[model samples]
Target chain A: MKPFPAVLKEKKRYVIFEIISEKRVKEDAVKKAFFREIKSFIGINGMADAAPTVVYFDEKSKKGVLKVDNRALKQVEQALSLIREISFNKCFVHIIKTTGTVKKAKELVKRGD
Target chain B: MKAFIDFVASEDCVSFGKKLGFSRLLFNELSRDKISKTKINIISPKSPEESKRQLRNKMIDIILDPFDKRGLFIDSAFLNIAKQKQISIGISFSKFLRADENSRIRLLHNMRRLTALVSKLKGDLVLMSLAAEIYEMRSPEQLILFGEMLGLSRAQATWCITESPKGIIRRKSL
Candidate 1:
């Protein structure tokens, strides 16, 4: 099958963020919490439109990257802010920055450390 | 750059607020004497009746979250009085952030109603973290995003964090 043209593909934004909590959280928990919160706020169809996926997460640093559809960037941000708890622990997911490229998002996460 | 201020529940979150890029944080604590030491005087009235009474006082810099209680806490008439008195209505983000799924829906409904009323009346409004702990504190942009979700325009949301709070500080001469 021929690959879709670049212009026809959905543009993505990489969000760089870190979890501020008392203890380190497992990557799986973070992923679960994010999906649940986003789905709850934007609903299942909106989640499909946003297409959020956990791209990277460092347990030690608690920094990570999320790739999402560009149009739903603000919706993703609202979802991130609404996330009050993860794995029964009170926490906040602080966004560092959002960029068009995953490489830039990773660089920001490193620089934020 | 715009300067932002947050009305918090304790002194401990001040450092965290600073880290989150807030220029200043005013404490809205249980002990009035503790917060009296500061130049800015803010009042978090318990009931809608108290909010009306406190709005008449020139000594009060802000009225924090009268909508937290269950009832018709604010209306066009209340906003008219607030506007005439140059008092700003404080909307705490944590109240919405911390509510359970059932109550969150109700809270959001009430908040959207308040926002619409404020816009219609052209009343002064401010948004704050009012975080009890560090974890509850959110960045200025996040809070503004919340304001937008509650039916404020982007500019109005920005003003809620910036100019509206600044107006309160300026009125108090702080």
Candidate 2:
């Protein structure tokens, strides 16, 4: 049998944001603001072709997948689901930054959103 | 007199769909509890696995069609047996809820496939306990992604923080 080459992996990067609001209604608005921030400032240049982004939500923390070449997104979301964050109301979204180009992982991370 | 639907055969799904106003209701009577909500059942002479295999085979007959073969329109012909059904779709995490490393890796692949399928559908949001799941998704980001996949300009995608069972105002993401 031909040996399978180890899949290329990329270094991970994260984008964080906080929109201050005393109002509960502002929570949704703030999240939208953050998405706009990422897309306009970072998502377009870094993740134009990206889909299947897995966004995780917990009590005040969030995670999402921006882009990845061969990264498994569903497992990330399911793994997040296994988290017992049912305790915390606020949450996070974790995005797998995959270009499947491990060679460019650092460069991609450095180009901040 | 208020016009109502009557079942000449039985009070099964086609009748229920007429009553409920949805042309079809997504359901899989995998168990008795799943059927309890709907008040109907489809008993097969074959065992569950055998029946599932048979059903899958029948589905593949249609799924293999060159033009009409989008997996989104999966065949749940027998799924119509339940009454008062509200599309009881399950997101199984049995694989991901594991401690072994290899299994965890496998679970991720399943999730990626799931994400892609749901993201691709982009329409057909399920009305859930608290909110409308645009494409079987549970996260705000996916709601946005599905919205955009359906070509919602960036501004049209909106995510409400609270999970409310009250009927959602927007059927699809803006």
Candidate 3:
């Protein structure tokens, strides 16, 4: 038999998760939890997509930058300020950004945190 | 054996030093007196694994109060150790560890960069030591976790000594 070539395989992926945040992200602990989970996936060299995603603040089409940080616990403070009320009449909106594998996107969507 | 002294005692790190027979110097005295910030330094560990472990343990404390009314609490003992060791002080000092959003934002940004660095390392953990001369400060907990999230083990673990000049050290050390 001719030389057998061994091919190694690893599942690498990039996924962007956008959430209409069922509730305005005003809880620091909740946001911290969200990012903390993200942290686990961030540095995996293989079988993972480690890239920084841009957080876009969208209201009335006015956009600014939001940093995803463990310190952004004040998101609750800010969310509390902006949330006049939350009711179950409308759909939560989110746009998954340009990225990688479908499996990654599914993983992000499955994250209830 | 010679002993090291810390003038700032933002936390029990000084007491820990005392237990070790390194003279307990409260950092508050130096910071309160408006002492020179440049007096101390540290020699850090070459292993990233150690720094990461310290960062993980201390970060639990830092994130406890990332932004609070009391602001960050810092101890000079960590700084003095860095100085005594003659090590290069790397990242993890807040230029202004304060409650203000502007300062906190910068601190958060730097913290992100640090965590990113930690994520990249090949070591089991990355370690770091910080030195702050102490001024009006911010949440010490945030400072601790920010380092922790980035893989700093213990801010003082790497160094063997911290130097505090006599008379300036602190009465609390007594």
Candidate 4:
């Protein structure tokens, strides 16, 4: 198959979220919970299509940006919202903003911190 | 602009919520003595009868978790009474947070049913974080998203998080 043109590429969204917990959260645990929650919410097929990825995470600030297909935005948001515990500590994921570009999402995270 | 309110279990959470951008805070326990000192008070009834009694009293600002135990506590008849008395019904997101997988699904289904009922009756519905700690608090947008997932429209969800709580605060002051 020919390489798809840039215009034909799948549209993506970046979600900026912060983890507020009693203990600092590690990136690996965030990734684990992220996939687990998304899988549980939408199942394996949906996970394959959603193709969510943790593009950026700062353990010190406990802020991160996730890249997901535009079609899966709601599913990803719902999954993130439903996450109550991470690494045995009660936590809350507060989604700050969603943008089409990574730059804008990163800016929002910086301003939030 | 919108004002956010959370019904908290502990007195210590009041100030913590204030720091987290909550304009107003309500304590969930029903001690008349403590009510006077707090920003707001929520009357958590033990049974349907107690809920009915509290709804009639103008002093009682909110009916928190009326249907948490089991079965339908707020039926159409009770909703009409609440509407006539200008009383608001509250649903706590904390319950959903603490529920396990099976229970979470059931809770969501119940919430959707209750939200539909409240909308049909034109009764006031408030969505509270009911956070006991700072970490448990949710942003306004997150609350609205949660509301939407439970079958409420975006505008309705926004109202639950903003206008409904404001109305409760207004009535409390008046």
Candidate 5:
């Protein structure tokens, strides 16, 4: 099997966001809530376009890195911004920054500590 | 760098707004004699008629949200008057963020209408957190993104957080 060429491949973006919540949210709960909101907002087809994944998340820092399709970056952001709560606890997810690489996104998240 | 201004519902989010990088945070309290000692004045009228009355008052830096208590009262006439008065039409992000799924749909419908009219009239539309709690406070970029979601162009959305609010602050001088 051969992978697609760079031009044919979907360009990716890393979004670093911090969840400001009253209590520490488990990574699983965060992932669940995140995908649910994205799916609900953008729908299945849009989710496929986004191709989002939680690449890294720190429970203590409440910061996480999400990998998504570059073209659907704004759609992912809209979903994250509209997230008012997760696991029944009120919270707000603020995008610290978006970068082209996961390493850079992780570094930005680490610097927030 | 553009100075970002946000309007908050209570005194609690003031410290949080500072942490979020907002240069100014207007505390919207009806009974406040001078807005806040440090913050600018903001008014949220209960009805379109009341909004018309508040537009005459020079003390108000921004007409926080033009809603008739339970419903939005924004129309071309209201926006034109607001434009003439130099009073920025504020759209609080928390209002939509706080609504349930059913009401959120209705709210979005109304907000889109407001956005189209404001853009058509070239009115000053200020987007604020108006967060009652610390967690409710969103970053300036997030507010700008939310503005874009509300049927505003990217540049127009950026203006809501940057130039629009700055104009109100400059006029009020606080």
Candidate 6:
């Protein structure tokens, strides 16, 4: 078996988003809430296909970066939007930008902040 | 670029929405008297007949929550009228925000049905936050994603938030 080349690999997208709430949130909690909502809304098969991951998160500023298959971008965004509460604090997730590479997404996050 | 607008219930929402990057603000109520202070006015019709009449009035920018009342608020007949008159229909995500478990299911069902109708008829569908406070408002990207979950395509959902309102403003200027 041979590994797929970089160009032949599945396309991925990085989403830069911010959490606005009365209190700050933790990275672990965000991951938990995001997956829970995604599972509930799109079911198990969709969740598996989504393959979402949290690449960057700043607890102090409440900003983070998420990675997922390009095809599941909408599902990931919807899951993030459905997250009303994180660890008992009411909150809202605002997606800032999406890019094909994490470098661009991180740059956008820095510029946004 | 895209202009984001939210139909809010109070004055505080104006500043809140502005902070969140909304360019225009709409005041939503059941009153016929226009709010001179605000640029955009959204009327929440009390009845299906009222909804139809509002949709035809060029002065009134949008008909909010046509499905809020009992029975079919936006039937095929009303949609035809709306499309011809170039009036936009608005749906508030705030309802889904506060709905209970039982009511949430019902709300989803109604919203899915509404989105389907709008898509089929090729009618103007506007997405509004209707946020009373700051936290209730969602970003433009989130709204588009929410629209997709309800059955609209990515491009269609984006149009609901951007072009639909722009068209309303363009019509007002004309």
Best by DockQ: 1
lDDT per residue (tens digit) for residues B41-146 in model 1: 6676777777777777766666766676475477788788788888787788888888887788878887888888888899888898889999999999899889
Of candidate 4 chain B, the 10-residue stretch with the lowest lDDT total is B30-39
Worst 10 residues of 2 chain A by lDDT: A14-23
By TM-score, the best candidate is: 1
Where is model 6 more than 4 Å wrong at Cα? Answer: A6-8, A103-113, B30-61, B68-71, B83-87, B100-102, B167-174
Q: Write the per-residue lDDT of candidate 6 for residues A1-113, one digit (tens) a residue.
A: 99999988989999888999999799999988877777776678987888888898889888889999988888778767767788999888888888889988888777665
| Predicted structure 3, TM vs. truth | 0.23
TM-score attained by model 5? 0.88
State candidate 1's DockQ: 0.82
When just chain B is superposed on the true chain B, each candidate scores a TM-score of: 0.88, 0.29, 0.28, 0.82, 0.84, 0.83
What's model 6's overall lDDT? Answer: 0.79
DockQ of each: 0.82, 0.05, 0.02, 0.72, 0.78, 0.59
Candidate 3 residue lDDT tens string, B1-174: 434433333554444334323443443322213323333322122244443333333111111112222322222343343234322223433222322434554555544443343234311111212223222121232233334443444343222123212322221133
- Candidate 2 residue lDDT tens string, A1-113: 87556553343322222111222323344345334433432336444432323232222423222332233333222233233122233322323343443235434434432
Local lDDT at B103 for model 3: 54
Error of 3 at B134 (Å): 11
lDDT of 2 by residue, B28-147 (tens): 332323323233222222243443443433111101100111222222343332111222111222223323444544444433443344335431122111111111113334333433
- Which parts of model 5 have CA positions greater than 4 angstroms off? A110-113, B30-41, B52-60, B67-72
TM-score of chain A of each: 0.93, 0.30, 0.26, 0.91, 0.93, 0.90
Highest lDDT: which candidate? Answer: 1
Candidate 2 ranges with C-alpha deviation above 4 Å: A1-113, B1-31, B37-101, B111-139, B142-174
- Model 2 alpha-carbon miss at residue A35, Å: 22
All candidates: CA RMSD in angstroms? 2.2, 16.7, 16.9, 2.9, 2.8, 3.6
lDDT of 5 by residue, B1-174 (tens): 778877787899988888888887877764535554355667777777787787777666677657632667767787787788787777888888888767777777777777788889998888888888888788888888888888998888888888887776666665
Clashes of each: 0, 31, 45, 0, 0, 0
Could you tell me how far off, in angstroms, the CA of residue B96 lies in candidate 2 after the best superposition? 3.8
Which candidate order results from sorting by lDDT in descending order?
1, 5, 4, 6, 3, 2
